[model samples]
Target: MSQSPEKKPRLDDPCINLNLEMNRKAHYTDSFENPSLIVRRGFPINITTTAPIDGVKLVYIAGTKHPQRDSQRLFGWKLETKSSETNNYQLTPPSNCAVGRWTIKFTIDAKEVEMQATILFNPFCKDDQVYMECPEEQEEYILSDTGLVFIANSWRIKPQGCGWVFGQFESRVLECCLALLERSPLTPTSKSSATLVSRSMTALVNAQDDNGVIEGDWSGDYSGGTDPSEWTGSVDILLQYLETEKPVKYGQCWVFSGVLVTVLRALGIPCRSVTNIRSAHDTENNLVIDIFHDRHGNRLESDDSVWNFHLWNEMWTKRPDLPDGCDGWQALDATPQEMSDGCFQAGPASLNAIKSGAVYLPYDARFIFAEVNADRVYWREDSDGNYRIKKIDKKHVGRMVVTKAIGCNDVDDITDQYKHKEGSEEERYQTRLAVTFGTEPDIYENVEDEDEVKMKFHCEEDYIIIGQPIEYTVKLILKDMERATALFNATASVYGYNGKFICNVQSHKCELLLPEQKVFKGRIESSEYESVVRSGSIIKISVMYDLKEATDMGFLEEEIPLRAPPPKVEILSQEPYIVGVPIQLKFSFKNRFSSALTGGYFRLDAPGFSSRDRLEIDQKLLEPGIECSYRVEYKPRKKGKINLVVSFNSDQHKGLHTYKHINVQNSKSDDF
Candidate 1:
């Protein structure tokens, strides 16, 4: 009689909890496996459970927080089960899905389970339904305010602190952007984004103001300021101009493109930042950057120059005005170098136009093509000042153009997508086709030289601290016995990223015999020019020499003595902080230079810090030789090791950072 025990709980009953199967969780991995998994929008999301359920519903919520299912839910989806215990839901997240960490609540009858997932906007998605709505672009490019973008000095995308944090328009920023937008005659049409982006190309750069917005100084230094993060974000750039009606100081190609990304995204256009290494600015549209040198091996200045890296923006949209397949990923350059129409804007240069060699596209397709795929033509000058194409290098122009991966920290190489691989027959043909568009093909005979003057020009170190000296050693080996006297001249000028000339710092001119006198040197004491220089400024050194008094010249260009301002803030804190314990974080702001600092403000920004932790300096002016100290009392809200970053900005000094880390111990009494 007592053998009739209590019945076992049924699997489908609300009392029985549903948990994800261990094998399912272990095997179904995402490309990026942080606490939150990232899945491309328009792709299938599969979930395998250990228990069978009657029905399933998914509720998307912002961030990782999950309150009881209610109207606060972003969206809900009824999942379709592949089997009783497996959920192979082919759910495509719309582009409008918020870009950030999101929690998805899976409701299985009365029991519920939740997991963290991040939805990313993928521009390359080809699904007709997704593309028609273009949700990915709408969410990522237009709606999202902040994101990670890649910037580089060269092809290889190693994080040398080159990645930039980009913030688009918030409410205040949007207000200013709207006012600016009114000035431009842009209306919502099929080609509205392309048109607005074109206007932004020139409008973002203050060409009229010297050292303000964009510094195109080729003779001077290129440093806009201490750090790229000094502007804080795109909104800060707009507010500075809108409030003051004065052009903001400092901006490079990256800065210009970053601002363009903000403006375009704010206006409901899909956009992102792109960087091209060894990028060419084909001012003449000849598809060749011609450099002339005297008979000796010295480099001379030309109208066309190649930058270390070039930054531009790409907006995703449909091109009803253009032919088919040229609809997505149009390049928009905000850097005020080349002018499109009467303004300094560039594309909506269709990448498809780039691939297809469609030079007749609405925007500047040929210019964008040359930027990433142009062949460099090195011209040699003779004794009579006559020059011939010495050598053409097709392989060195574009190497590794990269952008931030859709949902991760890694870089995504879109080089091949922009142009065919170097040395490929298709690439050569495309180059010729792209160059010869709307013009008769000229036979480039004798472009390759049988004998070329080999020169080695390098510095002891590529980077030098501000207030230091930089030395460049040049060596030339003559291959022709007919070469006579060589006149070597090395000129150093400071310049901004906008390619504008600042000031000539140093110049050395001398005569040497060919083959006998091959070595020449030049030095620059950066400290002498420290007062006029900032970090990211360029010390452009050009060495040009003539051989046998022949006009055939050889040229070498090098940038030396990179400068950065001294740090303004210092941090000191004890590690292993305990949760619920008040921690004393001490820091100091000391002016390192002779001048006073005005309008100084510092902000404490991190996940672990409270919003009220930021503060401005009590005194508007920070006097030289004075050290200001501050002590902040902070308590750990969560138990973990966390990084805190404090950034300082002012009218005198633009960028400075103080960072600290603290590990908090979890305790029973530490519950918030």
Candidate 2:
């Protein structure tokens, strides 16, 4: 028993003892939640603790989804007092600290206390009262990847899939951007960041021509017959612009806004897209969007139009050259709708100043202001040929302006951030004050008798499945006791999520006599639209009725839902694939259709796979009664259950998918 020397303990043994010290647990005398405010750079941030704790070190970490590389030491400091606990610590972040959501951690004794906060690039050090009045997510939303967005001219805000915003930056995109930089007159020699922004905007839209980069084509028919969804990512669009200096065919306001967001983000500027519902375009600089109607009360299109939804961008920056109140969150519109300073670009207009009715600020502030705060006037000529207002809608111009929430996929109601609540005393006051401050006196003086045309409008269905007819009924319930004539115009228009119109599937126009209640019915047959339209199309229904004494108008819009495309092939694979071993796949398909399909291809995508592009078929055409099979192999790079997706598409058939889950086990053998 006294015996042999005890075997030396293994280094990996859990019971092996060594020099170590136990850390103390963090215990606070008082508890409090983190503040919901932005931490300005180059400013001292003060944090207070319940107990007086000394020997404490504070570390600030940047927020990132990746846990491994998440902790970035922005600022570090130690307590200076001799007491066991230091009640307060003031930490100052460097001037170049990143502007984003950040976490602050305190190593008290050996334990840790953590809190979350936001960092902003406000150089002027605006007071908390001002920043708080703006909006919480204004800075965060613009800086983060996720954006709360509005689409299809709808007021409801929802999360939109913007994966393209974060797509891998291609070399060609960078090259094109760099080429623009070379051609730009802006350099370090320029003092204002606005100059760099202006130059970048000029290069992005090629500011010389209104249709330089993306042709503002509402008629659609884009380049390569590509739809807005097919445009893929910003890199693809930018490269297309560089390779061929022609305007990409289809770009609406949202497309222009999206592209501008991508370019601004790429250029290291914090930007976000904001949608103004019932946005007005006052072409006359009259501070109002004019609506003209014929003597019969039929609505007529005018130079000044109101887009159901208009999108523009807001960039975070300090404007040193502008007036006192004009700084932070400058608006920029690259849609090329109007000219600014002899160019088609608009804004870098200050949102702060925009709020206070500083329409006198430079860079088309008057036009931008009119978008959200313009008057909507319906005018008609009397028998005497003098134009008079049929009705006036002040609250309809800007409603429910929204943005994306920070760190979440939800809508951020920034309507208050843009303007006051509709019809509120403050709203009326701001409107009147703004007009008095800058707008002409005659714009608001022409208020006339309200046209008492009361109508209730709705759609039977909100969405439509692709390759199907769109059936909807517009019911008009006239509350006024008057005989009226209703003019109905309904069109099934295919558009991108960015509001780029692809084509008009079908258009219908009819005249109806309005009684107490009348149902205006319409249908878009599948056969009529199957070839011309795809998913993401909208049925825009407009009804204009003129009463003998007065006239009014009504409108309704419906979104079409697209069903998943039919499967083109069947995939055969075995379960439990061996890691480091090849898994063979067989895709069997038959083409029995009358037409031949050229550009027939199959694509396989999965995690840890090295496939770059879709595999091309040896023979392009698949004639009628042709049976074809494709064989491919993939070796699992990791061991686990992997979702492998196989897709097949042709010039005729698009977006066919087949997916399977395959269990992969690690292998001991190097070669198999």
Candidate 3:
């Protein structure tokens, strides 16, 4: 009898077993072990087969639907024989492969077996577009999941670093990120390009355009959804979206940015949240923020206003679509501030282009340029009801642009990276260049300086913390030696961060003779505005001067941000906490207000140590001058330095958060 034909290898044969865990550590994706194998592009991942088989050809297909040949490739494996019956194959995805789930078909003779894997952007690979040359940046932007989001107005209060848990490597986050891309209108070809993906993500992060992720609610009423301030991380929001296939109820600028950073980082593209203090929302794209006021110096409702601070995201990638040298950090906003191409998306605009004032480039560069360098033009309604420019503020729009520093929680001021020094020659030149391409190129033409009397405001304290009296001084200086009498009015109002008027706190009016220099002091007690210090609200003190000697009036305003003191956190567990070991933490806060604080609650969030849901403890009331404390237990799941954030909120106080860094040692040894 002829030799029996060799048995054909079957798809379900026990001879072949894929090693899903192989090369995951090298790809920096060992943290994700779920639905399928996770690997980054431009890196070699080993797939082992139990039984060695000859004539095996592997074909890789990228994406799930309508897979194209451009993204598909065939590779003949060298087949490293691990043992007598086992073989390991190393497969390297193309550097430009589309990111998402990929199918790998193993062709043995005429038979085929298919396996699945997920591919991500490779910032570590040189050939990849998102490649980051610096090793430290790759660690901080791509690897470090916990970061700080700087809060507070830079001019009024010092920008404080608020701990934000990115949770990029959390369970189902990678899946959710891929699912988000699939939900968008991006094709497989567009998904392959980092620039396109980032641009698309800007719209996908908010539900305004595509029913994407977070539903933005700036209405101050968060009855049906969670308050934006209560959110400590993005994992819960994303998982909820993945589960419900609906937008998460409410998010502001920071929330949108936090979630975008998580999605970008989860896709293996380096990203960080950026805070632009005194950021402008230029609705007209005229390179000017117009503030119309009555002849008496009261702020009138207008179309354009400058936010106390605005938060957006910066993603690192090469912009091949633009000219050369635009290959670094690109600004992208998902806050739905304005529309781009009929969609609520902002950038992927190159920071290099932005710094150079090349606003003529693509993807909402004019809007972003105006955000950082727009001139604030004060327009006063004259007796004839026509608005005329009284004062032009060129340096107040973008005071300090900042982000979380590398390897630490401290703030890294990248203001210089975004623009030159304020009032500098280069800054002025760039501003002019930007205005040339703006909607109103002649906006600065014939703008006469009508201010004969100059006024300035200064805060007495280094920081005007909440629950303390605010003391500030207003000074008037005659630009020239001319005797003049002027009527001065100073009004203080509680304004939302978005420039919405909340409630007026105090107002003062007086007539004074303009000496060479005149100074006036004002005070507003904590009791006057303590109840109105909602999340991100600031005290705007506007001073209007009616000069008897001149035809034009003077308007000067200062935004005073009241800083909320962080709550205290104490780790009850002993030092040298180990992985998988239970650790107790105690959170406490003293009610500094004179009145009782009702609806008080404590929110605890620790990325690696706790579950996706934040631990919330309810307290009906916190007596004045009394310290309230809550204790909870958590088990360390992984070994590393993790940030534990504790936030305290009540009907009386909002936006009080604190964080503690805890070192979790490996259970195998003392090494962290």
lDDT for each of the candidates? 0.57, 0.54, 0.80
- Alpha-carbon error at 607 in model 2, in Å? 14
Please report the candidate that would top TM-score against the real structure: 3
Residue-level lDDT of model 2, residues 356-448, one tens digit each, is: 677777667778888888878777767787777766678667766766555544466777766777787877766776666444545566666
Clashing pairs in 3: none
lDDT of 1 by residue, 1-672 (tens): 423223333434333322323322332222111333445454455655545543433433321222324333334333456665354443345443433334554444334555555444434345321242545445555544445444344343252233232334233454444445444433322112344434443454444422223433333222553245443345556656677755665665666776777766544456787878778887777877776665556557778877766778787766767888877678877777776666666777788889777777878888888888887777777657887777777876767777755544457778877888788888888888887772325635567444335678777775655556778888877776546677678888876543445678888889877677778877776445656664345677876665655435556666653534433333344545677777776656767555677877665543334222346777778886676655667776545434455556666555455345445677645532
**Would you estimate the TM-scores of all the predictions?**
0.61, 0.60, 0.92
Span of 10 residues, lowest total lDDT, candidate 2? 23-32
* Shift in Å, residue 237, candidate 2: 3.3
1-672, model 3: which lDDT tens digit per residue? Answer: 634234443434454565556667888887763646788888877766654444434333433445445222343223444454446667677788778776655544334455667889999999999999999999899987777887766554557888788888888888889888776677776778888888888999999978899999877778888878877778888889999999999999998999999999999889999999999989888888988888767778888988889999899998888999888999999999898988999898999999999998877888999998999987777789887776688888999898988888787889887899999999999999998887878777656576787787898675666788999999898888478888888899998888778889999989878784388899999899988766788898988888877775777888887677679999888888888888988888888875788877778777654433344446567777888788888787777667877788776565588888878888646863
Which runs of model 2 end up more than 4 angstroms from their true locations?
1-150, 156-162, 166-175, 191-203, 206-216, 223-227, 239-252, 433-440, 465-537, 546-672
